[model samples]
Target: MSCFEVVDPLFGAYVLGNAPVKQIATGFDWVEGPVWFGDAGCLLFSDIPNNRILRWSPSAGISIFREPSNFANGNTRDKQGRLLTCEHGTRRVTRTELDGSVTVIADGYGGRRLNSPNDVVVKSDGSIWFSDPHYGIMTDYEGFRAEQELPCHVYRVDPSGEIKAVLTDFAGPNGLAFSPDETRLYVADTGRMFGSDPQHIRVFDVALGGRLSGGEVFCTISPGCADGFRVDSEGNLWSSAADGVHCIAPDGHLMGKILVPELVSNLCFGGRAKHQLFIAATTSIYGITLNRRGAQTP
Candidate 1:
């Protein structure tokens, strides 16, 4: 049986008919933040509730990348090929240096502690962007139960170590990614604690100096909320959904869906060709080879 649901003729060109969704790993409490290190020929992802980051390779299989990972959620690579991570337990964002030392990127702002850094992405200009949501601190499941010191907002950190709240209106900001050209930003508002608020993704015009304008609803995901996503070279967004991965065009229309058996939380393009979709679902990791390439920064 085909694992895809074709909604538009354009999406048919993006997927392979014979490429099946393969289960790469299993037996995890929850998984998110799948990032590919093509140079290393490995994929690193967060087993959030397990409080560790796991690494997978085509030849060696799975291994522990980092235990007691501060309940890390989302992850991405910087322009310098350093590992950038959002940690819920630490309520901060961090970068793993090439020398194997962990550097604290962002924790508190304006003398107040951040709620919890949930998802993160690095811009081509060397600026780091992440989302602060209360999900990690709401209970002891993911991180320690503590008082939220800051509102749920998206922040950006410059190369000079300056942190600024770029967007502050989200009840809960989950996943985020930059357009291929870096002229637009897409952010997911999954509502406060995944509650009654609308589950939709918003797009904004990124101006010079990172000034944002024109934040309008880009697309609303159905059967689930948008958790994390990555954009392709054509600016089409492949977002996580309840049933599987939903492909949304730049014009804010649903193009198609890649049906999976589990609830997907996040995804990234991997493989030597950057055409493989690595997915972090509820309790396992899955991958599928696609005909398109991802626009994610190395």
Candidate 2:
């Protein structure tokens, strides 16, 4: 059977008929983040509940990259090729240097401790942006249960190490990414854990000095919320859904779906040509080659 559900004809041109979804890794307690390292020829993802990060490559299969990872959730590489991670246990965002030393990026704001940094992405301007949600500290399963010190907000860390809360209106600001040209920003609001709030993604027009305007609902995910997503070169948003992955056009319309047996949490494009979509589902990691390329910064 076909693994794709086409909603719009444009999606048909982005998918390949022979490229099937392949489960490359499994046996995790809840995978959340998946980042591709083309230079290293490997993919790294977080097993949130397991408190570890695993690396997978075609030649080496699966290997433990970091243990006791402090319940890391989302990850992305900076312009310098260093790893930026959101740690639930520490409730901070950290950067892994080329020499393997970890640097704390942000832990608090306005003299209060941050709830927990969930997902992260770095811009081409050397600034780091991430979502701060309370999901990490709500339960002992994913992280240590603790009091929330600050309101959930999305943050931007300038290249000079100045941390600023770019957006503060979200109840649960989860996964986020920038458009190919960095002119727009897309963020997902999953709502409070188990709350009745709507689950949808929002888009903002990023202006000079990182000013944002035009906060509007871009699209809403069905069957599941938008946990994480990535934009392609053509500005198509591929978001994680309960049933599978949903492809949303720039016009806020569903284009297609990539069906997976597991609930997808996050995904990123990898491979030598940036055509492979590596997915982080509930307990497994899957990958599939696509006809399009990811627009994320390396």
In order, what lDDT does every prediction score? Answer: 0.94, 0.93
Instruction: Quote the positional error of residue 240 for candidate 1 in Å.
Output: 0.3
Candidate 2 ranges with C-alpha deviation above 4 Å:
none
User: In every candidate, how many clashes are there?
Assistant: 0, 0
TM-score of every prediction relative to native: 0.99, 0.99
User: Against the hidden true structure, what lDDT does model 1 obtain?
Assistant: 0.94
Candidate 1, residue 259: the lDDT equals 96
Residue-by-residue lDDT tens digits, candidate 1, 146-259: 998889999999999999999999999999999999999999999987379888999999987889998899999998989999999889999999999999999999999999
Q: Which ten residues in a row have the lowest lDDT in candidate 2?
A: 206-215
